[model samples]
Structures are given as structure tokens and as C-alpha cells.
Target: MQVIDADTVARATPFERLVPALRELFASGAEVPPRQVLTLADPAGGAAVTSLVMSAWDPGRYYAVKVINIAPGNAERGLPGLHASVLLHDAITGVPLALMDGDAITTRRTAAASALAASWLAPADAREMLVVGAGRVAALLPAAYRAVRPIERVTVWARRPEAAEVLASRWRSDGFAVTVATDLANAARHALIVSCATLATAPVVRGAWLAPGSHLDLIGSFTPAMREADDACFRGASVWVDTEEALVKAGELLAPMASGAWRSADLRGTLAQLARGEVHGRSAADERTVFKSVGTALEDLAAAMLVQAAAG
Candidate 1:
């Protein structure tokens, strides 16, 4: 098997390439099985260990398996809280083809997916962007948003005000108008809002605070017990997801569904429908659009395919 490091993966897959690949993978007629998650908890540290396994097949073209480990406190030491690796194999022969850095693949594919969703769901004239959380994903949001919208102003909010300011400064140096917001409500008032934090139990942005013609992308909260958006958020907007199966299991849609404010049918459609033109997106200029992403195996498989091809 060819070993691929993070830098190699970054060089191999670009956001532009991954976005369309993901769009096509979802739009194409294919089958991807649900992911399996195994969890281990530490009562003393008040944390849990999670291992995720995802598999997908585009039938005769490719197949892949991504395994990820999640430990919440690893971020305290300046390391990513989540780590992952992916294995690509020949569909016909079952031979191991490539081993890739799953963390980089995950972030890139996720940002690309969010950007793709924004392209269809957000207004074409969108000019402002707000991102929650100052982690690696937060740093990538602006580039992803700019790919889809005409984002002129970028605002960032995190539990640590200093970290928010730091990220804002970095973005400013990169030639974008960036600011740090003390209140998440103030951040939510932007034209496009991206949530990338790892808070497990609290809602950061309130649905009432969202402006009309706004696009919200919730990329955190990968488990049923975690929620970034409140029930009212779902009630106030048209909800779209990467996949209905993944969303129903663990996504921003979970909490609202659990609270009785929303139902499974409330989901207007999936990214595949939107991309394939089967479903309408942002019917009106003033419509509130929310895209809830729980991440997907097909996205990883698609991205890994691109990376592997580029590596060769």
C-alpha cells in the first residue's frame, strides 16, 4: 500500500476538485452503507472515546473505509481532538491501494460539502460570513465560503475571545475584513453563518437571531448527545442535509427532532436532490436556509479517490 501523509493529501486534493467530486458521488446512483461507531467512556475525566468506521461503494469504480478516533480533551494539548485514517482498495481485486490521512481528508471534504451546499442554498449576493469556533475548521471556513459567495466581511466567535481575535487577525492579514464577536447572537446576524465548534450540550446560535436571506451551515455535533443549533433554529428555516440517513442519526436535525419541534419529513431534501435539480433551493431571496452536515462516508470515499488518483 502507498502511504500518504497529510502534506501529500493536501497537495493531492483541492477544495474545488473535492466539492464537485462529492456532488457527483451523491448525485450518482450508488449505495453507501451506514457508518458504525464504537464508544468508550471515562467517568473520571468526564469524556468519551469514539471510533467511527465508514464504508462506501460506487459499484465497480471504487470502495473505501475510513476509521476515526475521537477523544475530546486532546485539543487542550494543541492537538486535534479527532484523528483518522482511510484505506482505499481495488473494487475488483480487494487489494489495498492507498493509505491516507483521514483528518485532512475529513476537514477538506467537509468544507467542500458546506461550500457546495452554500452555492445552491445561499443567495448569490451574499457578502457577509460568520464562523463559530476558532479551530482548524474555522480557519478554513472563509476560503470555503468565498468559493461560493461574495463574502466581504467575516466574523468569528469562540469560547475564548482571544482565540477569536487571533483568528480574525489571521484572516485580516489574508486580506478579508475580520472581526471577533463576544456574542454568538451578533455573529448569527450575518448573511452566512458557519458553526464548527465541538460543544456537546449547548446551543450557540438561536434561531430567533438569524436574519432573513441567511444561510446557516452546522458542521459540528456528530453524535446524538451533541447539538449546536436549538430546536427553534430548525423550526424557523428550511433544513437540508448531506444525507437523510446520516442526518437522522446524528446532526443538527437530531435535537430538534427529539424536542418535538421538527419531524423527519421536515427535511426538504438532500444535497443529492438539490444538486440533481430535483428539489428547489432558496425559493425566495428572503428565505432562511440551513444545511446540517453530520459528515458522510461517500464524501470521504470520493475525496480519497481524488487523492489517490492525484498521487499516482
Candidate 2:
């Protein structure tokens, strides 16, 4: 099988193309079973580690499996917190096609999915963005969101101020009006789009800070123990998700339900419904929207297929 490195994946899946590709992938269908997750206790008495296995297939075409490990303590060592590998196969022939960098695929596809959702949910004139973290995914969000909206300015807020400043500098170099935000609440209040990709177990974004017509993209929380936004963020917002899995796996949704602040019935729709025009998104100019994503294998498969095709 051929090996596709991270750089190859990055070159193949630019946000301008990947965003529309993801929208098409969701509109069409793929078989994606629930992701398998295992929480591992650290023998060294450190933060718990998480292992995830996700697979998806398009019948008679391609199949992809992604294995990911999330080490929360990696940040202290200045290493990426998430590492992943993806394997692609020809479903019709049952032949292995490629082994791709899942970390790159995951980051790009996740950002693209958020941008796809924003195409329908974010205000037509949205420009200012508040990025809640400075991790790998956060670095690509502006590029992805810019594919759909005119994102001219960015405000970065992170637990580590230095990291946020570093990320801001990179954006500024790219010609964006960027700033490091010491006050998250103040930044969030003025941002037209608030995209959060953090691994915090506690709520970081509060609902009261969000202004009308804001689009909140919550990408960090995947497991039941992780949360980025609080329960109040769900109140009075048109909530959507990448898939139904967010209801069961993400604490962003689970915690709100447990506290009687939101219910599954309150959700507007999934990405598929929006892509297929089965649901109304941002009907009013003043409406607030939320897109909560717990990553799905279908997105990975779609990204892998794109990479494989580009390699050929």
C-alpha cells in the first residue's frame, strides 16, 4: 500500500475545495458506525489517555479506518495532544490502497465540516471570528471559515496566553487582522463567529456573552467528560450537529440535557439535513445558531478518498 504523509494530505485538502467536498459527502450517504472509544488510565498517574477507532465505507467503492490517540498531557511536553493514522481500502476489491496521516485528515475535515455548517447557519455578512484555542485544529479554522464567509479579523483566546499570541502572529502574517485576547468574554461578545476547539472538561464559553446572529462552532468536546460550552449556550439558539453521535458522546450536549437546559428534540438538524435542504437554518437575521460536532468516521473516509484520488 502507498503511504500518504501529513504534508501530502495537507496539499490535497485545501479548505476551498474540502468545504464543498464535505457538503457533498454529507448530502450523499456513507455507512459510519458509532466510533469506539477507550479511556486508558495512565500508569504514571498522569492525565487519562483516550483511544478512538472510527470506520466508514461507501458501498462498492472505498473504506477507511482511523485510529487516534489523545494524550492530554502532551501539551506540557510541547507535543501535539492528538496523533492518528488512517488506512484506506478498495471496498470492491478488498485491496489496501493507502495509509494516510489521520491527524492531518482529521484536522482538515473537521474544519471543513464546521465551514460547511457555517454556509447555512452563519450570518451572510459575518466577518469577525473568535477562536477559543490555539491547537492544531484552531490554526486551520480561519482558513476553512473564510471559504464560506468573509473572515477578515480574528481574536484568539487560549488557556496559555503565549500560545494565543503565537497563533495570532501566524494569522497576522497571513494578512488577517488578528489579536490575542486576554478576556475571552469580551472577545466572544463582539465576534460574529465563535469557533471553539479546546479540550477543557469545564465550560469555557458562556451563553450570555454571545451576541445575536452569532454562529457558535463547538469542536473540542468529543468524550462525555470534555466540554467547551455551558448549558446556557444552548438556550435560545438553533442547534445543529455534524451527526447524531454528539447527543451520546459529547459533554457539550450531554451536560445540558442532564441539567434540563436543553433536550434532543430542540436540535435543528444534522449537517446532512442542512446539505440536503431538509431543514431550515438561520431563518431570521437575528437568530443565533450552534453547530456541535463530535467527529465522525464518514468525514475521515471522505478526506482519505480525496487524498487517495489526488495521489493517483
Which candidate gets the maximum lDDT versus the true structure? 2
Candidate 2 residues 228-258, lDDT tens each? 9988899888899999878999999999899
lDDT of 1 by residue, 1-312 (tens): 999998998887777677788888878845678788899787877568798899887788778899999988777768778889999998888889999999888888888888889888888887878888887777778877777778788888898898888898889987799878887776686545555555556787788888887888888776677778778887868888888775656646767777788888778898889888899788888788888887888888989999988987
- RMSD (Cα, Å) for all candidates, in order, is 2.9, 2.4
- Point out where model 2 deviates above 4 Å: 38-50, 71-81
Per-residue lDDT value at 82 in model 2: 85
Clashes of 2: 0
lDDT of each: 0.81, 0.92
Q: Which candidate number has the best TM-score?
A: 2
